[model samples]
Target: MSRLKEAQKSSKGAAAYSRYINRPLGRPMAATAYALRMTPTQVTIVSAVFTLTGVALIALLPPTVWSSILIAVLLVLGYALDSADGQLARLTGTGSLAGEWLDHFFDSIKLATIHLAVLVCWFRFFDLPDGWLLVPLVFAASANVFFFGIIAADFLRRVHRLEHPHGPAEAPREAWRSGGLYSLAVIPTDYGFLCLVFALLWWQPVFVGIYTALAVINVLMLLLAALRWYRSIRGLAADV
Candidate 1:
């Protein structure tokens, strides 16, 4: 009887770990927003507005390095809002497919605007030589690729969860701990962090290098997600 009890405890721990690892970081904010009577759509619109303001400040302001820093700060706020919208919806039981799709659509637009703002800043203020715009352009494309890739991967993960109601046993407890750490790591590695780093290192071409590397990784992540999604659907079809 003791052994059976121990085994059950272990199983429970493992399931808990898996859930912690797979969870996103926006739940708290979502809860707060829901308590405050904000809707997901409202949060989404507010996030976009903040992001647009950041881009405009960066592009149209006087040629000062401080402006870049301010823009970076605003960009971070924009990202936080972006996270809060979905969270609020989930917490408030107001989540819908249309809201999710619109969130993604606006996310892409926000990314594009950020890149364009950076390019305009460099071109207008820094006065780079001809063809220098290509640098920001490349970085921008990479940023978009990363954003879209992450979204795709998340969608595939959700679909898999839905289809596999009871596939295999849950993961080990250690796996969940590791996954939580990985999610935290995303805070430093995300686009907002990249932008802040670029602002600080604008004097060098390191920003360009960082952007390129991030873009490449984004593309790879997207491809892996697409493959996983395809496999999940195929497996479901086979069962049917």
Candidate 2:
């Protein structure tokens, strides 16, 4: 198969929105990155730069629609680049443990940083309830635990050469393809969609409603995911 085609295949994600949308958006950039002979780590770094720049701008800029929109655009670009790096890695046959670590590290940073950035925007601008201000912080902290648990569980399974925990009995389903209801549960946690959420920040009610809803949903989902992964790991160990 051609490199581009292979890269295209590699772009698919477990989330339907990602497979259908984000991956497609990133394909052209993946081709570009390939042409430029960019390394996966370099692509990862560039992705972070774009994403963090957007987050920083959101925190620093005056609370205006224009600033919010620009931040949204930057974040969308960052998400595309994020998708591109893995595709680039697959295309170049440069997938490495170190490269994987770097990719995951960047992902974790944004997991926390994005929420913190939003909190900054709120604290600096909005007159939200003091208790409400803690939601983002809660999300930031809980999300890390979720991520760490998931990754650690996967690592243990890999090291143990255990069977894929959720096989034919519980086939993997893309969050988007699942249903609108399921998608809503999963989508808000997505950084790609979170970019769009920033645009709603200037509108207080819309922003707060979304922020609180997403935070609660995402935290619950993450905790459940972590629990599922932990159970899988424990089951594997028991079988041993």
Candidate 3:
């Protein structure tokens, strides 16, 4: 099967088993908005607003288990908004260079703020053991490092492709599947999910452990991507 087909199949299977109940609802709304002539950039901006509000709410809310639950709901809404923006952009043919840049910019802000808000809540409202704040900060920093590395690697890959048009082209199918995985590398959504889990479990330490592991994996993936880009460029130069 082509890489695209394989990726579609994999994604379909994942969606089938996903615990995210809002996915189905999100798609139709995205489609409808696209049909209504809304640009992806608009949707992305809206999503960012929601995300910022959610973070602010979390930080300012009174300390209680219900507050955590409310934050989790907001996180889920933010996720849906994130998905909708991209989908709407693609469906409406409103994708652009500016839109892409804006998407990444807002995404970085959203990710950083979410964790920052959580850390604030933990420090100000709840009393955790000493050095607990460091856990979230470390995880956030590690995630940002990996995110930056991936962006650099992607830029390198594009340059390599431009330099060598015929140098053992990546299987379009594998490229598609890998593209999804690489997208995951960009956002560290897993880290956000871990934060939510930690909030629910009240196990701040365990959340740190999970985020640390994910950061390591993300860094490794970035390294692999960089290596691939280097090899592709080298192969192109050799051909020349």
Q: Per-model C-alpha lDDT, please?
A: 0.61, 0.77, 0.60
Which has the greatest TM-score? Answer: 2
Tens-place lDDT digits, model 3, residues 107-193: 788667766776786787666775777766765665576567657656766776787777766534345444444444444445345
What's the TM-score of every candidate structure?
0.64, 0.86, 0.70
lDDT per residue (tens digit) for residues 1-240 in model 2 = 257566565322244456567777877888898888888888889999998898898789877888888888888888888888888888888889998898898888888788888788788888877788898898788778877886897788686664655532433535454565554446766667767788877787898888788788888878778777777777766765
Per-residue CA lDDT of model 1 for 1-240, tens digit only, reads 222122211222122212242123344555566667888998888888877887788778854467667776677667767766755665556789999898989878877877787788777766557577776686677667666666765675567668777765333334543454554534433555554554653443565566556655655655664675566556555653
Kindly indicate the candidate among 1 and 3 with the higher TM-score.
3
Backbone clashes for every candidate come to 0, 0, 2
Which is superior by TM-score, 2 or 3?
2
List ranges where model 2 is wrong by over 4 Å. Answer: 8-13, 162-185
Q: Model 3, poorest ten-residue lDDT window?
A: 1-10
Quality of model 3 by C-alpha lDDT: 0.60
Residue pairs clashing in model 2 are none
Q: Which one wins on lDDT?
A: 2
lDDT of 2 at 106: 86
Worst 10 residues of 1 by lDDT: 8-17
lDDT at residue 136 of model 3 (Cα atoms): 61
